[model samples]
Target: MATQEEHPLIAEYRRFSPGSETLAERSTAVFPGGDTRSSAHYGPYPLVMDHGSGCHITDVDGHELLDFMNNFTSLIHGHAHPAVVAAVKEQASKGSAYAATSLNQIELAELIVERVPSIEQLRFTSSGTEGTLMAIRCARAATGRQKIMKMEGGYHGSYELAEVSLVPDPNERGSLDAPVSLPIDKSFPESVLRDTVICPYNEPERAEALIDTHAQDVAAVIVEPVLGSMGMLPASHEFLAALRRATERHGIVLIFDEVITLRLGDGGAQSVYGVIPDLTCMGKIIGGGLPVGGVGGKRELMQLFSPSQENPVMHASTFSGNALTMAAGKAAMEAYTGDEVKRINALGERLREGCNHAFQQAGIKGQALGMGSLTNLHIASNGVLHDARDSIAGMIAAGHIPRLLHLCMLRRGVASASRLMFCVSTAMGESEIEQAITALHESLAELGPYVASERPLLVA
Candidate 1:
């Protein structure tokens, strides 16, 4: 048994992080919970970041730590890369937003269209949320269908339609054969819920059956190739193939929500699986650490957005394709190449391997799961998980251990998502990966006894 003061769990989190705590208090006066994003929050408080350079972020508390959150996987090249910084600085003087089109927007779009095979035409939006919204609307318009299909645990954005059936209770989620659409929040209208058909992830036969059953009314089937919010669960190639075949047979627009997963590779997750969707919703890395989103697809489907076309789907955003974000995105994308993507993805694999080793050494039932440059830590020893239900169960069983582990890592000069999902950046190298591994080892050792004692359920 460890002494109270000597316990690594309690001892490691005692450092003064006043800058973050103080700023959090001040922010609470205006923003709920002193933060805008619920995913970024952690117990005791999150670090108030002052600035970031390369893979390091300096918190207002003056503590320097390696950043793995990467602004929720938006900073593909890491903070303020020379190219992006120079572009933004140069473009800021030229003008940020203009009612008219700009050359930078055209260049960025051309780059994306050239890289993503399925996207022959594309349009920019202010956020991934908007990009998804537009994709759904376009699907509806193109097919004249009202219903949509989405994975039970897949998250697209904040809209009611996109968020439907996101967090279904096990009791209400129906069986694996036929899933039920469970509302994520009460704010969702009954009509929206009724229009969404929920399908299980990684279950190809079940998904195909569901899509076939609803083919006539379903306009689109939106999925994240790698489910980001649900611990980065990658969809099986068979599952995605089933979707492609079913949607093609039924004339349903298949949408890939790569908003977060776009950073995975040069061609994105689509390239990895060799399965292409009719429409791809993208954001994050494309913005170069700025706010931006996009929806792109085959020229035929994208032509529905043409202003010159009669009764085109209406879409507009004051900040969409703003010159500043466009310039930064162009610079960032230019800096990233196929080789760079492969290198960063290799680093992510290293991080995951190190984390798995740490869990084994600590005699804990935890595992790191993810693909390419994105990864997440699951506090379970149950091998691999296929869906969100398994992820939630692992988290629930861990009690406060996961949160405590996050705090411990922060104090040890490392930062990952509060939920323990992390992504590698181009700015990070082997040294940073090793630092994260060392921190994980220390945090696990710190929390080991408690997990073995109080959270006995977590022990394998």
Candidate 2:
């Protein structure tokens, strides 16, 4: 199916997913650049997925791949899990949504509150963006402050400020103590830069200084327990502790954007670190593969959103607590017990070891970094990355190898985030983990000669 007219690698890729190219050609007319989602977009064209079951997905080109992307870590139970499908089917038969509230919404909320200690009371939203937005509004309503202090590489949502300095250029980003709020895209307004006070990640002292400096005007300090967009970097316990202490001292609300990290445990990443945030934003895994998001926290703070209040924050969405999403979420969360969390985390540890082994065996400068079931591959000699700046160093060391590696893996029947994010699902067992490990070794082998010929520094 590959056309001989293209580059050998592109031709081989086309051969593997030829139908994808044909579909992509047609898609460009409908969707910009043949893709609606930017994260999933890559060179040539992404494989057009036809269907999925458990931990595997089949493309239109007839290539079956072990799906590690899991719809950007949303499918904790993987595609078409029996429980989720049954829930969706039953809810669909009745009705997808209604003007009135449903019992399913309460059930899902109760489930989340039971697991996460910080979330004494909660509210649902249609997406994580709304969840973070409402959390900030609640903070402002409570403290009567406007500005927010966020970590240098933290990504809370799709908005301009939420992604401020998501990929901070070292040249533009100032000192760690007073990091300049740099916009990732041109869509950002100057107001976003003025309102957001950027703090260096994993630097407790710098974070403390920033919070103290902006304490008077800072309403909330938001951060991700594990920086998802910046290479799965885990925030240090000391750093989080600093934020907690500073926020408490300054009456500034602390928000933990646990959207991607809710999968870390039944209690989420905050439980793992033993440091709780005043507010927690959640999504992905909780939605049961349907679009969903939530913000939950202490009773006093949550009271700001209560309708009983005279001038409460007006938070409304047609699909905020929709029945279908709640039913599916309840099913997924109920099945994803504490024991299952431990099991998947154990499997993640195995996968990490396997990847480290693969890099060593292949004599390549690559390492796997993450917490629990979440993982990201970094091409670097450095063993661990603590912040975006550290990740930039790794990015430079690897050059364009990571993208080539992703394409190579896709051809070898494996799929992950273009940024190389890999997560474990309840649908995957030791066998699937092993298969992925083998894929890593084979992928590196296929890439080794090219790296040796092209970039010698990548060789160990």
Candidate 3:
């Protein structure tokens, strides 16, 4: 809920987007909280987008805003790329899905196998949630173990165990050495918490020690190279290497959840870090703006899903590897070459640098921290953010400033994740990057007085 003091910004937003406000009010009659997806929802209400082209999305009020969020970094080519649209149209005319395998599915899988080092064989699912769930099941079947070790802030999917200790509350998270498995909400079962071991992000020695203690019952150790929900904090090579060494020593399957981080390079973050995992779970950009998920690994492990196996992992989904998604994904991935990856990554650096400078110029205690096409804003004293705890502390200290800033940016003709995560798409260029930076400068200027009065600590 928004506080009374936040009404000014909320009022300004409502005034600017009266059409969206009406739509949101009407939506509450059907959808819960005026929105169906929780991640896309914000405090006041989200802008209802009508259509998108290139990097610009027009809301219902006909406001053409630059789309930096890219549908939470899934739309790598931004909205409706010609090639992707062509492929989807062609496939849709034939048929959306089929009970048997299709050529597009085989082609996309081959492309992925040729690119990613960790995935020798793979299977698709309807969403990233299913991808991670299947990966965990595969590990348990192979190792005959019940426990799964995951990072404190790492988010795999929507499932219970995948979300264990997702938000590291400073109060309930216990100590740095031994973090408690805290749930995001009351829906989580106690059994999920017990089965999950929470490892501190970016802490190498502590993670190794935890793995050593629970090596016996642990089936798999899953991690994201770049922690997505926790402010896009990138994991250190040493920390990932530590996980690899420990998991290899214990004979535990190591899984890398590269759903969001696959945009980092041609072969994903595992290629960037040179620390390979036994199983790699993927989604986001791989789906080419469609709902898709996949998990792949060494032949020995992935073969467990083979029907020929006496007792396979038992994976089945109605829309897994559907024709329309496969066609779209193939076209999108084909266009996303190594050169394109390099270009967008350079743009990401430009965005982060410009945003950081904007914060300094506005005299605000904030900074942009992320790597290669992904950026997240946080309020901090030293601009030094290491983990979820650091990111959440900065958020708590800033009160409602972050939410206000999001609205201010949207009004200034820029759109990002409500939490302030930004990414570069193929449709964006240096001009769009500069536009976002300029919007940040103006938004901060508007909010400067409010921060000084209500949140003095945030006024640097």
The model with the greatest lDDT is 3
lDDT of 3 by residue, 251-295 (tens): 999999999999998999999899999999999898899999999
Off by over 4 Å in 3: 1-6
lDDT of each: 0.88, 0.91, 0.93
**What C-alpha RMSD separates each model from the true structure?**
2.7, 1.4, 1.4
Ranking by lDDT: 3, 2, 1
Q: List the residue pairs that clash in candidate 2.
A: none
lDDT of 1 at 137: 95
In candidate 3, clashing pairs total 0
**Candidate 3 lDDT for residue 398:** 75
**In lDDT terms, how accurate is model 1?**
0.88
Task: Count backbone overlaps in model 2.
Answer: 0
Q: Which ten residues in a row have the lowest lDDT in candidate 1?
A: 1-10
Whose TM-score is higher: candidate 2's or candidate 3's?
3
The stretch of ten residues in a row with the least summed lDDT in candidate 2 is 1-10
Displacement of the residue 386 alpha carbon in candidate 3, Å: 1.1
